[model samples]
Target: MRPTVLLFDIDGTLVTTGGAGRRSMEAAFEKLHGRRDACDSFPMSGMTDRAIVRKAMHIIGVEDSAAAIDAVIDAYVAHLAEEVHKVDDQRYLVFPGMREAVKEARSRSGFAVGLGTGNVREGARVKLERVSIYDQFDFGGFGCDNEDRTELIRCGAKAGAAKLGVPVEECRVVVIGDTPKDVHAAQGVGAECIGVGTGTFSVQALLDAGATVAFPDFSHPQALEILLGGR
Candidate 1:
């Protein structure tokens, strides 16, 4: 097989934070700006941590400078450390077949597996550690890398290719995520995306968004083959 890079998205793709992320961000915004509802009802699916904070700042009428956004994210991470544990075990879940699929991919030669997520490094760590899956990925293109999902995906693809000492263009990159944004990001970087309907979006929705393929979850019979770029 040719060298391949597999980038996985964290929330909604591999696991569900069970509202811990939203709660933490809301708490952080309230702690800094005195408005708990600043983030209420905001469409946050697939948005970066920094971007979420930035939007909350705007909703609360606060100035959203880089330093300001950083402050909110810092506080959010602190709250997340506690929130991840607070959520009931049933609420926080690693979707079925995801861990096994990741293991299978990593065990293969010439396959570089890592994260392509919207969470910042610390946030990803806190959430993933709750389920003991944080160490599975050694590198990723995090929200800290770029606020734009496409740019971050590109960054992840580049990093994954570098792990095999190959130029990004020479390696086949596949993104596994659960949102239209994830699909769009993969397309933005000239990579393929395998969309999972583990999140708010349905498989058909992801397909409409232009995913190379879509499945209800990692448990689909043809998932591994499709993910590995086989028919």
Candidate 2:
């Protein structure tokens, strides 16, 4: 088997933040612009953190300048750190078998596991820290890497390949995520995507979106096979 790179998405795939992300973003907008509904009109799924703030600024009739986006992101992260702890435990959840899956992948030889998420590095840290899984992924392609999903996914693949001391082209890169955007991003980089239906999208929907395979969650027996086998 060739050295493989497994990139796991944070939100919805490994864990749900119990609306901590949304609330924090909303609070940031309100604090900065006095408009909490800035992002309410659009879905934040599969969007980069900077992109999300940029879009929300546009919708709220604010100039989406780089500095403005940074301000929102900084504020959002601060709020997220606090909100993650305040949310009801029932609403915050780590999907079934995600930890086991990550652990299993880590134990395998010739495999490197990390994150490929829309969250910027700091935001990713805060969210995963709440669930006690922040240390699993040592490196990633974050929203800060690029506003475009394809570019970020490519960035992640390259980083993973670097960890294995091989060219990205020589490594089999697999992306595990919960959105059609994940499928498209993996395709963009000539990687395969294993879509999970733990998000708003369904398994059939993910398959229709061109995922190599779709599972309800990592708890599915076959999920590990395809994840490890790269077929």
Candidate 3:
């Protein structure tokens, strides 16, 4: 059966942010909170931006406030621009076969593509546009709205179902991502999870997380074909 909606994670799934996210968080701490090492060793993989910022603030013993959060976000955006500029030949890379996969999925009838990521809406757009795939997604769930990854997946699934004029139960939702969190989120919503071992996690690790299928990478044409067919 054709999936009614395909929900994808941004980092480590479709593209690499070229370490922009880490640099941006570090800069945000330094510029807005007067802390230089707030994000020195924070584990950001598969985490929401809001969660990252909140954790950083907690580590620095700062009281959370809306104004402070907004300031940090602003600093992160500015820092992202600067960091992206300095990486001369090391810009973000769209994963191999991603273009073809997206093209084929989007071209199919009853198939709608959307994002289920830990990035905020604007950040998601920035990352996707950098890799020239922003236009492929019809809608997305943003980390700025909620820190829970499962909730974001639900939000994404709902949005995609809305776009397709289908009930959430009737929609064949597939979540494609790179981490255990992604698998957990997909399972939380009763969606199929496709884990790609393009990030820190190994294929076995993702399989342990209950991914429906785990692949080391989808760069191979045959693997890509199998993945597409399975979806």
Candidate 4:
């Protein structure tokens, strides 16, 4: 088997936190900016927390400075952890076959799993721990890694390659996600993208966004083959 690294996305791809993330983010903005709906119109798919904060600040007519953005990130992480615990059990959903996919990947040879998510580090941990699948990913690139989604994905791929004892250029890197942004980001870095429609977007939407492949969920009969075959 060739050296292969799979970078997975949290939230919509691996698990769904319902609106817990939004609520938490909103609370943070309200506390930091006195604007309860600062991020209401922000597009969140495949975006980094840093980007989100910056966008939200712009929308709310606040100064978008490095200092302000960092503050928002820090506050959002704290609020997100608190809100995750308060989320209803039913609201925290793990997509069907995703856990199986993750387990299967871990069991397979030449495969290293890591995260490429828009969420901040602590927020990612809390969200996954809420769904009890946090242990599957030991390393990842969070929104804090960079404001650019593509860069964050590359960061994850590099880290994954490091864990696999190979350079990223020598490995077949694939990004598995649930939104068009994921596909677009993969395209930016010339990597393969498998778009799952477990999020707000549909399969067609992802395909339109230039995903090489799109699926409704990981429960398809040939899901395992399709997922692993990206390499």
Q: Scored by CA lDDT, what does every candidate get?
A: 0.91, 0.92, 0.83, 0.85
Expressed as tens digits, the lDDT of each residue in 193-212 for candidate 3 is 88898988999999999999
3 or 4, which is superior by lDDT? 4
Candidate 4 residue spans exceeding 4 A from truth: none
Query: Model 4: what TM-score?
Result: 0.95
**Residue lDDT tens for model 4, 28-92:** 89989899889888568777888888888889899999998888878887888888877677878
Give stretches of model 3 more than 4 Å off. Answer: 221-223, 226-231
TM-score of 1: 0.98
Candidate 1 per-residue lDDT, tens place, 95-124, comes to 988989989888888999999999999999
Q: How do the predictions measure up, each by TM-score?
A: 0.98, 0.98, 0.93, 0.95
Candidate 2 TM-score, C-alpha based:
0.98
Give the lDDT of residue 158 in candidate 1.
91
lDDT of 2: 0.92
